[model samples]
Target: MSHEIEIHADGTAAFVSANTPGWHRLGVVAPGPMTVPEALKLGQLADWNVRMEPLVAAVAGSKCLECSKPLGDKHDDMCVTGDHEGQDDSRIVDEHDTTHAVEVPNNRAVVRTHPVTGLPEVLSVGGLDYTPISNEEMGQTLQAILDQSGAIVDTAGSLRGGLDTFITARLPKGIMVGGADPVELNLAGFNYFRPGKSSEFLITPVRVVCANTQAAALYNFRSRYTVRHSPNAPQRIIEAREALKITFDYRDAFADEAEKMIKAELTIKEFERLCREIWPAPDPEANSAVKDRDDALTGTLMQIFKGETNENIKGKKTRGTHWSGYQTVVEYLDHHAPVRGEDADSGRIRAERALVGKARDTKELAFNLFQVA
Candidate 1:
């Protein structure tokens, strides 16, 4: 499955792409760019009225275990589920009353009512304080950005069975790096881990070329806005219009940096120095395993640099340029870096880090180093 795109219980793909089809080639596809409202409807994200509901457990009991008193409609003690090492202290059988529903404290179920059936499906669980930002609210957020920025919806979808959701918008124009490759800017909004605690917005600039360049762009996000879910989250989202201004500022700054990188040439020695700084030589006493990995890593980066320089960008060769070196590091980290496990879950973990986690920090370091070089 492409990025574990969520498949709804109704067998429809919970994704939609505008203008072009995604790699998975599933979900709804639009022939042209869409407004935020259009994208939401096509993406099956229009009616997910997500809300928090109290979690309750059924306990059968007439008398309290400790005091032998007639247990009323409520029970305050701890309860256990099923059989395990501990005894089933929660369930008590009452001849008069078979079951009494007691609310589980400190936790809630994230639920969405089915539009057609009126039934409810529990999407996930969270603490009592965890607030849900409904799909309608997220749509309004996207619409607000489009109204302010003149951007069009590019794609929208849910991942991992609607546990995580996202929407991306394409900016009006693109920056031409090195007077050749066009780097397009996109605004991505994401809510992770099943109506997570916060929603994240980021501006990403990507070269409209190869997968490597796209990955580099994904790793190159420099401006971000985050709003934690709370009673005031909706108001904060409304105020997030300021993010559009920040987006333009970040675009201008990135263009300047890209121009500098493309013009500054790197000598072979300088390239070696850059590698040494990024991946310091292991101590002599360090195990052979550590040293071997480091050596292999540096070697791989060198190989990538040579290949990148040879590939012509818009009729201009990037040979001996810091731009080539920067691409080398980004491509390696994004595609060639060693990650634990070979499953889709592991891929998601790596992708997450590449966006705003450890890999992001490393990419930024490389970019800064090249700017000085």
Candidate 2:
């Protein structure tokens, strides 16, 4: 009997037995804990058609079943090339193939004829085993982390297109430095089926008052955790939680460090020197194009210094100190970095990484320059 996988809006999924007509929940399977076949059997839906709803719809990208090629456009309606061109006419051809003249599903690529049935068979690019890290699993993991850390969920939701999702939580109260508001923790996940990329989970830190979110850095005692879907993926999630715990333990230290940086003072000349060091001018021997690029970057730095950028540092005392300088660079990086893609989700990730990396580098520079103790 045929079976069907039913995905719910809450991110949970269940398998429905065609014959028995009952819903069976598919439990979380750690990476490498079981092969796809094993997972299918365990779910008792080995032959069931797996259907991921809007949440993971991007997972439908085409992957070559024979060559193990990476998934192509999830919404691609037509095959790029004919799978069978000069093959025997007796072989079954997909209907979508005008050249071969056979009937097949429009959404699938024809693999080959079924050995026994002699009928054209089609498969998705990811094949049957490329099960994604379900939204349900992601939600559960986020909740688990919050519970372990005694954090309360402040907000949670999935982005449009279901390509990305995030959960924000407020860390336990009373862990404040001076008069600073409580820190907020954000955990986000993405599903991208392209080559050289896999589903990923990320963690970041946000200032409660300012709502400024930055990439977690090692110096902050918090390194961003990325969990990829792999055979050992379940272990990775566990590792991520442990890493988060370590970061939580050092929250006080991180806040203290941040406060120190904010209070540190710098002269105008010192701030200029810091910017020069962080973004050096082109060498004398460099070509005009390179020089032009350097000049543009320098101009951006100057704009930040002149308060022309969107990074709001209004309450900050403009003592021309390292704090102001640091804020200027961060605002520039966070709000002005050029993104290369049209996809807003991908662009946001790139921008966040750039901001975090630049902030980390600037902090190191400050430390070396004696701007921060």
Instruction: Report the Cα lDDT for candidate 2.
Output: 0.47
Indicate the TM-score of model 1. Answer: 0.81
221-334: candidate 2 lDDT, tens digit per residue: 444566664556567777776776666655566556556655676666777777787777678999999998887777776777766332333444543555457656766665
| CA error at residue 261 for candidate 1, angstroms | 1.5
Candidate 1 stretches greater than 4 Å from native:
60-99, 115-117, 193-197, 211-221, 308-311, 343-353
lDDT of 1: 0.72
User: What is the Cα-based lDDT of residue 77 in candidate 2?
Assistant: 26
Question: Cα miss at 193, model 2 (Å)?
Answer: 4.5
Clashing pairs in 1: 60-92, 163-194
CA shift at 313, candidate 1, in angstroms? 2.1
Report, for every candidate in turn, its global Cα lDDT versus the true structure: 0.72, 0.47
